[model samples]
Target: MKTDDLITVLARDSSPPWRFRPVLLAAICGSIIAAAALFFAGIGFRPDIAEALGSGRFLFKFVVTITLAVTASLAVGALGSPAGGVRRRGLLLAIAPALLAGAALLELAAIPQSQWGRSLVGHNARFCLTLIPLLAVGPLACFLAALRFGAPANPGLAGAVAGLAASGIAATFYAANCDDDSPLFVMTWYPIATMLVVLAGYVIGRKLLRW
Candidate 1:
């Protein structure tokens, strides 16, 4: 059966109205807190976090991740609505990438080309890949499950946005623990890890949020 038809049938059989916004908000807040708790309990911040905070590279990581999280969260809201805004919301996803690319360019200009490879292959590439998704688990689950109450025009797309949002939240936490703060490393591995979550969200959303 068509997803719309399925939803219509479900809606007809259901009596109570479902408010998507509050639930989504609750899920976002709760999931972020949960992720933070898990991060602190298990991994915690890096030993040199105080020193790292003074570094531009370390602070820039937060700028990128936070911007990504905010933008992606907004896009998820746009996508979750039944109203038309798929294109605009999709464009919003680009800001994080654009910022990272600009940072990478600056890094390239500031640092010698010979050191580029070393920075890109920083010490924690594997951990970055592993932990971001590990950290994303809560946000992704909360987002997808919360979005079930929403009438997103395209569930798959909504799910993907949720993935981006999740990754952003996760990356923000992981960055605290990660000692490697090079823009090259962030640009190289962060997106790969994000794609892992996004791909997972797309596949899962196709199945779980189809309507």
Candidate 2:
């Protein structure tokens, strides 16, 4: 075939460029929803949730987790595109920590200084460490699978964002069962748990996401 004819045929057959946003949203959202369902089925909301709802501490717990989820989800989605990465500069991912730190400060000011350690060392440290990562499994897998559809220039960063998103979703679910309402508790243990997942994602993505 002539070069012109080949070019014309290829142009005629070419489809629109692939868009990953919708699928990315679906995968992340669906994983969270599924994990939430399991969480509710296995461990219902805090029995005192109605009373707890009135307190800023209780509500702030959700705020921290959900905000992390939102920002990390956005970052992960951004990283899915070849040029969408913000991790190289580390800007997008900074939002979660900054917000948490602000909350932590507010918590410190509101509570007794002597009791600071008590709030930070809430009763559920073991549970927080275990359950957050446990809940992260599905979302991490789903987010990683979603990344397969796009070209992420930094697989490790993309994967770490996915891990952050997963941990946020997981922590949100765990918050319902967690009796510790203090932002200090969340600020302390949650990051530790999420970092474990992020490390795992980095290692896994480095190996799995090679194009």
lDDT of 2 by residue, 1-211 (tens): 9755754564455443656788798888787887777787776788898898798877787887888888888888888865566755367567677878998899899889999999999899999998889888888988888888776767998888889888889988898889988888888999999999999888888777766
Candidate 1 Cα errors over 4 Å, as ranges = 1-16
- Candidate with top TM-score is 1
Worst 10 residues of 2 by lDDT: 7-16
Candidate 1 lDDT over 95-169, as tens digits, reads 889999999999999998899999999999999999999999999999998878776667787888899999999
Error of 1 at 189 (Å): 0.2
Counting clashing residue pairs in each candidate, in order, gives 0, 0
Task: Tell me the spans in candidate 2 whose CA falls farther than 4 Å from its real position.
Answer: 1-18, 87-92
Q: Candidate 1, residue 201: CA error in Å?
A: 0.5
